[model samples]
Target: MLALPTLSSNGITLKPLTLSNATDLAEACQDGELWKINETSVPEPDKVMDYINTAASMPDRQAFVVIDDLTGKAIGSTSFHDILPFVKRLEIGYTWYAKSYWRTHVNTTCKLMLLTYIFETLEYQTVGWRTNIGNHRSQQAIERLGAKKDGVIRGNRVCRNGVISDTVMYSLIKSEWLPVKLELTKKLNDAH
Candidate 1:
């Protein structure tokens, strides 16, 4: 059976990706600043529909559209992918925020909600995060989440742009989550 895909907290909501979401998905991908840090280009409408269809059909990929509760608009995307049931592990990836929402409460709320769902709801023992080594912004965000820096995987994978990037890895184990989550929550709640 498939795990039901919906998670919400405070005013943030995460819902499963759908073909109807292509327009917002494309808009989220418009900012070149975000694209520079990501490995894949934000797809065109037709391409986004393909992404939605393919992702929804994938048994292991639990993709969600990050929606702002107040405005009810799609602002970004995130997913629990590379899930390994036997090992009780999952990877939080393919995350991108609309440029306007960057460094806002929205981002923090989203991360906190996702972590809560992953470690508490899904009972995942470990959650992994990785980014292209050249993407310092992403590296900083991962570290800020209290994820321990694991070694980088050299020539880890090729980007959609056809360039190979060494991926810097980070992870948080369940044993380490409570305190870390507490700290992150505090930081996210505090005035920035």
Candidate 2:
């Protein structure tokens, strides 16, 4: 069992998913339009509590509501799922943000914090991402993070709206993390 660390970076913090987060998560899920770039569609507020509870119960899945300590509000959500500890790999997905945080440093900072943990702390060899092929913004974002394009898996995934779609695979191996992390940090700092 991997113990999750209390992670914080640049005023952004990640708290483990819990029943206490239901309302804030439900409210964040109200930004349904953000699903355009998010492969998983946001659930209705009425369903968020159950959805979050279910996530909290999953042994291999851990979700976090991205919070900004400045205003003490949840700005978005991200998760580490598809954990394969024996193989030392985990897929980072199910990420989205409120409109106010988009195009800001929040996303990168969140990724930086999470990747730092996954690669450095956990000593995990690989971190992977799968994005809907049609989601160009997500594809670009993953690329900008310096993940290597491993090629597309045609018709590899299904969307929330019940549409079958291809997935573009990207990954960062442990050996490649240093340069990428340096580049990502520079980009994030330049933006600040």
Candidate 3:
């Protein structure tokens, strides 16, 4: 099993998600009733435990709760899923934040942290992202992080609303990391 260490920077932290995070996760999800969204994997308030348990049992996934450093609150969640250590690759998905955090520096900071850790510390060669094809916001966010659109997967998976959705794929290989990292860093620095 892969162990995820707590990572923090730029006023946010990503800590390994645990069953104990049920309350925080529920509260975060309630911010915009995120579970009502058909495309995301966010669990309803009553399903938080099941969500965490499932995440814990998944050998290929390491989930993290996004915490706001100054407020010490769990504001969102993201994960390193579809791990393939043999190929030094993984996908970053199952991510969502309270609606309030949208359009802020949080997403960019988290991406920078995760990408740096994967490319530099873990020496992972590729990081990929997948989103519901209808989720334009998510696609934009992933693209802004410098991931190239790989293509689409038809009938990828059943969404929360029980609809089979097409998945839009994106990726960033190691060779593309340095410039992306620099751009992300510059964005974060320029934000202040």
Candidate 4:
């Protein structure tokens, strides 16, 4: 992956993930249930820092700190993983938010900002999404973004329970980005 850049729009900002955000990210992750459907968890602040560091070191990934535009505080994290610039494709995964931000405009805004950059700025052709097959909330949100369900695959090994789990895959190709982007823009406005 190329050097990641800070992205801002729809009252949200995505800055490169950094260790300085560990404290806030840890605090935001107080709800252990947040990890129930995620492949990883941070049960402690130090672990959160470790997570941030590990994400930063991924050669094919670019993680970002989701900052609340109003409070200007780190509220969550998201990333573009499995970047294949040669193929013009990437996966949007490893996203999580504070329990307080759930069902709010935070995720929608961040997705819009990130997707816009990927499809328009970065010129990626396909943005993929994947989550535990049992993670209904995540699957639903991805669908809401007009990402089409591609298929399911087993052996996604990073499951929270330490068991290899089935992964539900979805994709938003460039052809679908226009309508999805429009709908997401409308959602952000309606949310306000």
Q: Which candidate's TM-score is highest? A: 3
Model 4 residue 130 CA deviation in Å: 0.5
Better of 1 and 3 by TM-score: 3
Which candidate leads the pack in lDDT? 3
Q: Would you list the clashing residue pairs of candidate 4? A: none
Q: List the residue pairs that clash in candidate 2.
A: none
lDDT of 1 by residue, 1-192 (tens): 237467787677888877667787777766444555446434543466777777788778788888878888777788788889889898888788787877777766777888888788878899998888887878888898889999989997888678888989999999999998788788866845
- Report lDDT (CA) for all predictions: 0.78, 0.82, 0.93, 0.83
Residue 131 shift from truth in candidate 3, angstroms: 0.4
Model 3, span 41-149: residue lDDT tens: 8899999999999988888899999999998888888999999999999999999999899989999999999999999999999999999999999999999999999
**Candidate 2 per-residue lDDT over residues 24-88, each given as its tens digit:** 76777666555444366455667877777777788888888899889887767788988999889
TM-score of 2: 0.91
RMSD of each: 2.2, 1.8, 0.8, 1.7
Between candidates 2 and 4, name the one with more favorable TM-score: 4
Model 1 CA deviation exceeding 4 Å by range = 31-33, 36-41, 44-46
Residue-level lDDT of model 4, residues 126-175, one tens digit each, is 99999887779888989988999999998755665677788899999999
Query: Candidate 3 — number of clashing residue pairs?
Result: 0
- Decide which is better by lDDT, 3 or 4: 3
What is the C-alpha local distance difference test score of candidate 3?
A: 0.93
